[model samples]
Target chain A: MDCWIAMCVPGGASLAALAEVEHRVLGLGEALGGAPWVVTHQVRAAEGGHYAGSLQTQRGEQAVVQFAELADASGGGWGLVDGTGLVRGGGEETHMAHALASAIAHRDRTEGRVVRFPGQADLPEQLSLEELVERTVVEDVVRVGVAEDASPLLRTNGYVRLELADGRVRLPVIPWDDGEVCPFEQRDQHPCCDGH
Target chain B: MSGRHDHPHGHHHHDHGHDDHGGADYSDLTIPDTELRPADVSRRRFLQAAGVVGAGLAIGGFAGPRPATAAPGGGRGRLEGLVWLNGDHHIHTQYSSDGLYTVRTQVEEARRHGVNWLVITDHGSNAHARIGVDKVNPDIVAARSELRDMLVFQGLEWNIPAAEHGTVFVAPNSNELTVLKEFEQQFDGTVNGWGAGTPANEQHAVDAIRWLGQQMLSGRTPSALFLANHPARRGIDSPHEIRQWQEADPRVAIGMEGAPGHQAASIPTPNGPGSGRGFYTGSPSAASFPGYPLESYRTFGGFDWMTAKVGGLWDSLLAEGRPWFITANSDAHSVWADDRIRPPGQDNSAYFNANGRYGDPVSTGTPRYDRGDFWPGYYSRTWVGAADRSYMGVMDALRAGRVWVGHGDLIDGLVVTVRGSGGSNPPGTLGEKVTVGRGEDVHLQVRITPRRTPNAHGDVPRLARVDLISGPVTGPTGDRDAMSAPATGVTKSFEVRGGGEMVINHVFRAVDRSFYLRLRGTDGNVSAPGSIEPRQDPVGNSDPWQDLWFYANPVFVDVV
Candidate 1:
């Protein structure tokens, strides 16, 4: 079974630091005999915003044991969560992860939001945001366990599950950044009219 | 001069001593009644001689006597007895955080490049507002006295709240420094922490323009102007923000930069910066207005997309019958391939903060191709047609929209006139309005003087084609974010063959609706089907010299 281990580092990490953290997470997953591990940087807009690093491992039972040991060593802020449970949990943890990511990546688009998957190459330098979105394959998503009376913020949350027309699970995934420079959020940003 | 009083400069008292031909009303120097044709005389020479020419006064082989009927009274009529002056208003000096060169060096360079007037618009910042604004005034005053023929105005590149930068300048006066310092401290986005894209911040931008107008109205300054700079480069200047600024105070926020500075940034590698033209290589951000397309982040034919696209934002504004104008300038922080470098040993940011400006640039002797701008008047120029060559005259001309902008010395001069076909009524020139009887035909006559001399790049530019773009006055749109005027497009395109003065004429027959017509010309180096097909400029490596263009302000024809 596939499962995700989420880690929250209260303060935001730099792009370089996040890349190193992904490398460490991948190494730890490999040491526990979990191959095919994917680590993504999740930008969360809670506690004044920070990046929550999450790792998906195919050897879920072993990876959950490793997450427990790591959480005990690091003294907290780590969790072993099922992808389906997170989407159907209808809890604050699910809402926080989904809404913050949506605010950053899907703020402008009115249609299906762009969620990055593993193995996607870094966007070619100077490629515009429009071109990047055009090249990405947008998947149909079905919201599960979302209350109709949810606030506007919750309605825009990315806590969605991919479901086929017959109500079978298509892909259990969460919105993630592949540790690459998002075209929407450039690494090199200057204040308005700062003598570019 | 009924509507002349409506301008902020109408009650202007010229306190500066640089107006050599003081207080002379040249409006009376009309064309003489008799026919006198001088085939070899140039317009400049004729104006200098103050010689009265007859109905068929010929100058530079393209002059034809225009009817001298009494112009319509509201000062919206054709400007008379004018001299065209070339200038740049978006120049920077060491007062800017990212800038080099001193005020004297910039003024001297501007004079050497044939610019008659310039404004030192150092970037607005915390240090700039606190000290740089006041520190730079003495240099400007000295430059004015030393270079009596050149007009140097003190201004700042305002970090407009929730928008792009703007050139906010005032006519030179006793209150110039005080007004500028206070305005920068109170309203500069960087100084006031209003850079975010929020409703309150957007309103602050509008309020800044109104404050400038208030300063002018209260007699603190004779006149003031605010032109949004590099508006489309970052995609932050939304159409609604532009409309709000213009509507805030039409007298102050008169226009925007048609083509941004840093024209040389796209020069190919091993010789130039090899970056996107105007350094316009970024993507949209959260603060950016969503309606703008990806193409808006780039330059088309070395012009801002808003101005380059025929039926785009600029047309959208003009179609509403608003009198917003366009200008081109060298937002010169440093010159491309210049040998000047900041003095050695001092930490730049710390030094600037401590001393209010960088030490004067030192000669490096080795040219730095990585630099991304051209000196003022080296690559871009804004031509203003003024009744007199005084400070107030230039300000009045700009506010009146009697202006046209050119790049790379594309053309030596341009004269556009629109008249009622076979009627004796006075014609409308650039930025003027002519009331015509409904259904009456109108003739547009354009006389272009091609460059007889080589540009700074050591090549004489050739005029290849001229495009006439016109659109209906659809009135203001219900959606302020509207960015397109679908009805506006190229009505005609003229191909050029020789270097002599090219005269082109087009007639609008049986006109029924109120409309406006503007002109744009190119060297035929790079182009696609304009705003109709909505051509996109390629990403990078666009050589600024290879693509030259000139845009003339429009003439509105009011149908009654």
Candidate 2:
């Protein structure tokens, strides 16, 4: 699947509300069909009165959505604002359901969220909360590059460590240089771990 | 400044009247010509002829008492009217993004644990500069009024532009908040989005310190002080930065954390907040100063490796005859056994920004060692010998280096004096210099009072031994990152017997030029020779109450 999915929550959304939004996004795979998939989302508290994001879903088209109060409308609910900024004439629930279904159907190519090799790959079409936590660890470990000037270093810190399977794995979060990998020199220097 | 002195054979009379180095400049305190040398008289005449008098700071001193006195409780002439107030400067409250408790909660807990003075240092976050500082101000003022006996200061845990966190506090006044807000807005690396260690950021840090000094001088605040916190936690506070900070503004940037916070971090996990000693668990990073020895990355006997390593970075600073001091702090965010936890319904934004839901504070009867820190006055403490309880008095005492730091309630009180080899001469305490004749010997007298009651943790700490360390006071080195101490070592150790108050004396033979001596005592729970790492319990398993130690500032001896 190759597509984009974007969403925006109303301003002053509570933590519970944000979690609800996350739950909805994570369940997109099951909503579309009984399928195994991965998705990545960068979540942070929004400052202004609205939260907006664009996601590339499996629908082959990236869709951007926003959840905010409708301007000048007497009664309000979710509706598809056309590319020309005109809302489609439909009820909130019907419009929201249709928009989500279409975005979910537009799938991007799937890939592993955590890889064993250095280099960034494309983001997965869908990611679960469990998988999100796993990706954090993988990123943390790989982020601690072996050399002083590690080519593919993450601006944010490193990945967590739990299990290591064989072969060279790669994750999509970092931009590792092509055909360049330094041995784990930091492994010998670290007081505890041997980065093997 | 030359030829009137002799050494080696060491038979010379030390006037103890005037000093050329910086130790509370007392030229005006003494009557003119009382102890002026023929050479000084001639030089003054030459300067007067050149019409160069009154060109700079007049070297003026207020009418002050003589610098040295005898031990009061044990002997004669000890420093009088000095009260040892147990306090901490590096503390955090809910105003900090990562901190958890409110100002009232922090002050109440600190007072319950016997803290007479404390500085509330919330981290320098964007919100802190925008509104957090103002939000915490009223609570701080209310706490000060309610806790009338305690001195509460509003300060920020600054993310030093190129280094680690430091405590930058101002004397509480109408303009205090304004000064602090502007300072943070302009200099705080975290708030300004320039915290990453870089050359420009390092210069900004130096400029920030100098600006604090400017504030004090410009009367925006009556007084201000800065102390580097958890200096070696990340090994990013390079020796050059420490020196440059002091050089930038000696009055504003005075000392660093000798023993960092997170003292209870040693407690095993599932019960303890497992950050290891001083929360020192991370491997060296690109920003880390490369000159730090391997041992500098770990803690020894619950103290930071810089102070624990005898002749390490601290000694290097002292060796340079600079007034670099060190203190201990709880850096308390949440105390060990704290029961409140952030509810599942709230995210970090609401928890910190809006002060959302948190579990009700529970009783201490339930043990939760998983918490990483002890409240102010709970475990780590710095006892400052101030003249009064006011902000400036405390700042003056801190600037003068009249203080001692302890961990786990290691001792109730520590009194150390360096005087002429006997009870006949006046005594000089830590951070003061005692003048001695070329051939004369100097003695050190230490009086330690064991704890009368258990600490907040309910542990009764006992002293095992006190070690005295001394080193030559050689001025600044050529290499800024130098960490070697070839001539510094532990001179002697006094073992403690069952005690109420123990007084011991030591005498150093044939005096030389400038040098310093310091003190440290431990409960014998953990011990290591020189700079070796102390034996720590297995990770995720240890008790905060078992180990204890205390360190006092150094007293210098100047040979004339």
Interface RMSD over true interface Cα atoms for each candidate: 12.6, 16.5
Model 2: per-residue Cα lDDT over B1-560, one tens digit each: 22234323344422222333212211222224334443343223222222232343232221221221111111124577788898999887767766667788888888988898999998887777887888888889999999898899999998898678899998777788988999989999877766456678789999898888666444356567899998887677899988888888776788899988888876755666544566655434435675675346556666777887778888888887777889999998767887764445442655555552233344446666666788898888899987666676677678778899998788988888777753345578866667666657887789998987887777788898888888998776999877766788888888899968999899888776768889888887754323322432222334557768888988877766
TM-score for each candidate, following the candidate numbering = 0.74, 0.65
Instruction: For candidate 1, write residues B1-560 as lDDT tens digits.
Output: 11111213343332322222223212122332122212112222222222223323322222322221111112234545788999999998888888899999999999999999999999999899888998999999999999999999999999898878999999887789999998999999889977666678889998888888667544456577899999997788899999999888777788999999888877867788766678776544445676787567767778899999889999999998888899999999889999988897542789999888999899979999987799889999999998677777777778768899999999989988888764656788887777787888999999999998999999899999999999998788999999999999899999999999999999999999988999999888866433222223433356788889999998888887
Regions of model 1 farther than 4 Å from truth? A1-196, B1-80, B422-425, B529-536
Q: Tell how far residue A22 is off in model 1, in angstroms.
A: 13
lDDT of 2 at B437: 66
Clash total of candidate 2: 61
Model 2: CA > 4 A from native: A1-196, B1-78, B342-347, B350-368, B421-426, B529-538
Residue B379 local lDDT, model 1: 95
Question: Which 10 successive residues of model 1 chain B have the least lDDT summed?
Answer: B33-42
**Candidate 1 lDDT tens digits, A25-123:** 656666766443343444433222234434455565665566545534543245555545532111245433442332222212221112234323443
Highest lDDT scorer? 1
Q: Which model scores highest in TM-score?
A: 1
